[model samples]
Target chain A: MIWDWAFAFEILPVLARAAIVSIEATLIGFALAASLGLVLAVVRIAVPWTGWTISVLVELIRSTPLLIQIFFLYFVFPKFGVVLDAFTAGVLAIGIHYAAYCSEVYRAGFDNIHRGQWEASIALNLSSWTTFRDIIIPQAIPPIVPALGNYLVALFKETPLLSAIAVMELMQTAKIIGSDTFRYTEPMTLVGLFFLAMSLVSAVLIRSLERLLNRRTMR
Target chain B: MGIRTLVTLLIVALGVIAALATQEAYSLFLPGLLQGAVLTIEIAILGSLLAIVMGVLAALARMYGPAPLRWLATVYVEIFRGTSALVQLFWLFFVLPQFGVTLNAFLVAVLALGLNVGAYGSEVVRGAIQSVARGQWEACTALNMSRPQMLRRIILPQAFVAMIPPWGNLFIELLKSTALVSLITLSDLAFKAQQMNQNTFKTIPIFTLVLLMYLAMSLVVTIGMRLLERRASLGLARGKAA
Candidate 1:
């Protein structure tokens, strides 16, 4: 009974514009997490004494809420003289939170690579960097593509939380429209529809990427 | 000393120094944070109980119930799992008012979280049930057990052991999610941290104290879950074999 097609059509362009912010956060955030996670995974494996320290840090990041992490970076960090813009802080918190998960995925992939591969690289006189880049990382990456993709979808879904810090993402835009027009049914539903569409598309993309990765590995 | 131990000590030392320097801020804010922690725990406990119950029912409906019920369950899971929990809360808090069914903020938050987590938990439940070997299903059928009796007696016991670790992960996740309820204006831990920060303008100490409080709660949950998991897994092998 509350549905309004006119208002739905009216507010959609604004929502679409805001969806770009959400998409940007997801892409940049996922990039930071994926690269940082690879580094953490490698450091955890290569550096003996540092592994425990890295693990503890990762565990701390993993176990706490991302919102608190964002709040820390956005509100508290400036007090300690470490200032960042709200957008940057949101992306960083999401990146670091998911990096903990990604590192675990990479670690499992690292563990799965045959021990002989490391020994073979050593016998061939490859440097540690070469062994990691050429042997360990290549083998470690494919099995993890699916997991990384899942985090991508997850990160996309989590973008709305950035709205908490006033980032003007899709959800925030929808809320603003709803408050202004007092027509909640349209804008909020549109936001959910936008998210549903994005997730479904990502699910399809991940499935194909997984198939491609499996084929590449088989090859 | 190992680099790990040294680093940990250094981190701990920094925390001690910060606490000492901001002793007044620490004293004034700690009580507020603790009170907020109680509310956080309450939301988490109630939300998780709802989620687990909804999860069990949904998983059963999707995996074992008749066709129309399966479709209904699938739609429920998809709509919930596919969206953000924040938006779900907004829908309940904002949109539902348009339909003349306004829930109070606390109830709205709990419903949103419970439904969102329940969607994820249903997947866990479904996967756990399916992981109970196919042969077990056949064996139950051979024993002439009624469907309800078989599920209650045979399937659930085996499924429960497989369910524990993931449930633990979900439990921690659900607890952390209590932080989000603050968005709906619940006076929970995260909200309290922000409120104190706004009031005192001593953002660093208040949030630092808040972060540690959350981390300590998480550690407790992790430890409690491990204990529960250990107990649940006891004799699981023997049970599965029989």
Candidate 2:
């Protein structure tokens, strides 16, 4: 038997539990990315002097592989006295890495807003904070939601890389199962299916969220 | 650049050089890492070529082939695209032997990464082909060209230009993914770093060097893609000017 249904069923519970860790990592990492990315994009725009440094930092992060970045966080930072657990280090690396990409998406969104809108906010005597919070961000976010959602899915896929750091995510759990039982097919295939199902679900959710935003903005 | 930016860059350069100047560690680490980098580059290049071929065929079949081929292409793209690359590599490396088929680690690495990226590349190909303009297709038909001839002589040439930038992005992505091949026991860059770190406990220097090497390779991919894009577009510019 190339694939044993019984063995697959037996291992389903363990893989599913590990999947929660993967999902938590994705959600937390994405939250950090979403917020931190916005801040980075805003800082670049608002602080003209910081633009060069920020852009260079963004490009450096974007160009490198996430696996090494995670390793750097997990291993190197300890030498500098900033120790982080495997899970935290992995999530931070993924977050900061994706934040660079997400910032670009946000920048494009911000760019799409007409200059007159900023001029109008100034004319109305709105504080800069009010202008951004009540006006610019609301306008900027809708157009870029789908792009941000793509990153969400991308980040989810990246959680498997965290296993490289021994974070015990779904892929790591599956591999451990394989090593223990000496049966690779069922566990590996199940992990693949789990990723496919989750990504497909996220894609659908992103589409509906885009439509929802479009409707709200239209009204 | 501003003086501050220049200073910052200078400091970083000095730091990197100072770190690498540790003669004993440099001698120990560089050779193994470089050897691994060679294998990494080999996998990346071969994988990219495979990805391009798979992408073009899948995109063409999905767009124009018979129903069966189209369905097969669709399935191939989705399966490859949806799963994480690690799972796919493991399936090929570990599970295939279960069914009495075994491939070398290097072969599995290239096949898995290539097919995975090929799935993403197919979408880029499909989009570029679609963007080639309706009139171009109509003109090809009006000239009584066969389907293959129409695509070969007309559609693909124009589409190739659009494809270059996205294909560059995918190629860089493929290069990064080659790092995952190390997990299957290939002595690629990431695997080499981990192996050395475990042995020497020189985590900072080793991982930093690995990160910089990857960044350097990706930059090469980025710059190469830009030059290709510029060259590809020059013919269109000439035709318009003429």
Candidate 3:
């Protein structure tokens, strides 16, 4: 396990290439989770019958492990003639799993809204959609942004699970490179470092967003 | 009529439908899947037991130990809490073997999950113990009770009762987190479902079964926890009512 600068340099480019895939998966997964979570939350809160059903669905999704979901989607779905590329399946599974959590954030945000706002909206005879858009959402979203951002960082760390399903994300690439070179140290260390760096950056970014959102909300 | 009841009924209907649709496929994999489910339960229960032990020890160490021990406990808590459990699982399963300290998948999964959950649980334990009134501690001391005796008879009992809700939540989390062990080839429910999917190529049916099983497991845990909470809170409930 001697540090070989030459070996490190040789593998750096490959590791860097794999990082792009990891980032893409993280971003796509985060986007899907955020939007889907919002929809699930809104539906759960806005429509009683649908809300209860979605609540159970979300809970089931949340209680089960993401690894199983990813494997199911990636390896099983194709048997049903619904084939997704590894990358697509990876992101979709991650997104769907995290969406359950994100929905809780949204639910909390909705709960935090003042009761009077709902009454005021009803007094004005505003439709549910209009009332939610103009009044509740604007008030609900800011406080939750930081929590949601934290989940994004969490989602980034989870990208490694994608490798289990053979998505060739950063960790997978490291495994590949390590096995190829008969040296696990360099690639695995680099992968760990990559995670450390990305998580640090995201933490800082989320903290700043929290401050900015707080300042705006205070006014 | 409110939408809540309607939605509940609909979701229940959907769950029943999903289970019924998957009945034939589920029967085929039922034996293997149930064995996996047993493994899942074992990991969940054993991991939770380990977590409770570690959590109480770490919490005690942090509260009563020397400054250096406190710092060590703090570092342990922060590192585990800050990172993803999946990474910790990977490190335990993959990296430890490099150090010639290899463990089977089941052991590694339990250790990793226990350590991770213990980190979180320690905070809850510490908080619950601290929330016990100052008067209670003072009264024990005034009665000439030794520190360990006081802790065992007074402080810990109350703290343990208070710790139930948080522990319940963490148990649910631990149950879910156990799924990661399948990555290392533990034949837990997740792994079995994946195997069935690979063998039968019946994706929807297999996964539908997995989802329902998980839901049922979690529902049972949740219900049991609620009953425990109710039993523990009986005195408080009477006081409040009076």
Candidate 4:
């Protein structure tokens, strides 16, 4: 039979457990990307001395494939006495790679703020920290929430790359099922459906978030 | 001199020194890696052409075709866009044979990547086409031109300009994704790197070279797209002046 429903049902529990790993990786990686990206963006802007170096680093990361980055971290780092487990390497690689992208989104968000807003904060004799925290971040964040959400979804899709490092993510688990039973059709199809469902759910959530933020900003 | 210039020069010098120090390693790895890179470029170019064709067709179908075509196009775009490229590649590579359809690994790579990127490209195409002014459509209608005539002559030229930059981005994306083909057992660039790494256990130099090669290709794509954008906008401006 091309597809065995009974076999698919049998593998559901294992695949479900693996799916949790994938989800965990996505969330942790995104958190790292988000916070680290904001710092990278802020440093590039606030500390003029570091701007060029950060820009070059971000550009290099952005242009390369994430798989190679994972490989570099997983394989090469061990030689320099900085070994990482597969899951850690995968998460860090994805987090750092997407951080480059997320930083750009943040930079764009900051750039869109009006000059008057900054000048007003200065005229009020606000401290830099207070101005940034009170004036800049709240305004900068809302508009970029949708962009960051897109990266979240993108990062989720990237979780399968973790499988390449043998992290036993959903794709790797499915591949193991296929190899063990030689019945790939069911496992592959199931994995694909899982991804489709998760991504669609995330897309709907992001749209509503955008609407909710918009309604709040309207007031 | 500014610190930035000194830093930039220092990086360039380091890169040169690294290359000089690694000459023996380069000769050992370059032939296999270059052959893999050629295949990588081949897949990227062919996949890009397929993606452009699929993207245009799907976008037009969704926008202006009959109900069934629109429905089919929507399904195509959503399903392809929703899943990971690696899953798509594996499904095509490993599962299709169960249904009595066995494709070559190379063909499967191109098809999967093309369809996946084409899904994203469809949205870009749709947006660019929509950005063409409503008044232009009215103007075409008033002139008694057919739908295809209006789209071909008036709408597409303007839309094409906007599409180039995004299309360039998608093309680079397609190039990066070609790395996944390695997992499907095609000896693409990433596969060669991994294969070489396993043979010699020289992780640093192998991966470094591979990363630099990918970075160089992506830079070329960026510069090429920028040039296309410039030439396109110039033509439009000149046409307006005339």
lDDT of 1 by residue, B114-207 (tens): 9889999999999998998999899999999999999999889889989887887888888888898898889999999988877878877777
Angstrom error of the Cα, residue B235, model 2: value is: 0.8
C-alpha RMSD over true interface residues, model 1:
1.1
Q: Which residue pairs overlap in candidate 2's backbone? A: none
Instruction: Give stretches of model 3 more than 4 Å off.
Output: A1-13, A76-80, A196-219, B1-24, B130-155, B238-242
Ranking by lDDT: 4, 2, 1, 3
Tens digit of per-residue lDDT, candidate 2, span B1-242: 23344345445644674578577766578888989999999999999999999999999999999999999999999889888888899889988998889999999999999999999999999999999999999999899999999989999999999999899889888888888888889999989999999898899778777877777777677767777778889998897799
Compose the digit string of candidate 2's lDDT tens values, residues A1-219. Answer: 788999999999999999999999999999999999999999888788999889889877877788888887898888889989999999999999999999999999999999999999999999888988999998899889999999999899889998898999899999899999899899989999998988788878999998998898889
Quote the B-chain TM-score, candidate 4. Answer: 0.92
lDDT for each residue of candidate 3 in B1-242, tens digit (9 for 90 to 100): 13344345446745774567566755676677779999999999999999999899889889998999999998787667666677677767666767678898889999999999999899999999999999999999999999889999888877777988899889988998888888778889988888777777777767777777776777667667767877887865675599
User: Candidate 1 lDDT, tens digit per residue, A122-217?
Assistant: 999999899999889988888888999998898889899998899999988888887787788888988998888888888899999999988988
After superposition, which runs of candidate 2 have C-alpha atoms over 4 Å from their true positions? A215-219, B1-27
Candidate 3 residue pairs that clash: A48-B3, A49-B7
For candidate 2, what is the DockQ-based docking class?
medium
Put down candidate 4 lDDT per residue, A1-219, tens digits, no spaces.
677788989999999999999999999999999999999998887789998789878878887899989988999778988878999999999999999999999999999999999999999999878877899989999999999999999999999999989999999999999999999999999999999999899999999999999999899
Q: What is the DockQ of candidate 4?
A: 0.88
All candidates: TM-score: 0.94, 0.94, 0.86, 0.95
**Model 1 residue pairs with clashes:** none
Per model, the share of native interface contacts recovered reads 0.80, 0.76, 0.41, 0.86
Error at A159, model 4, angstroms: 0.6
Docking class of 3: acceptable
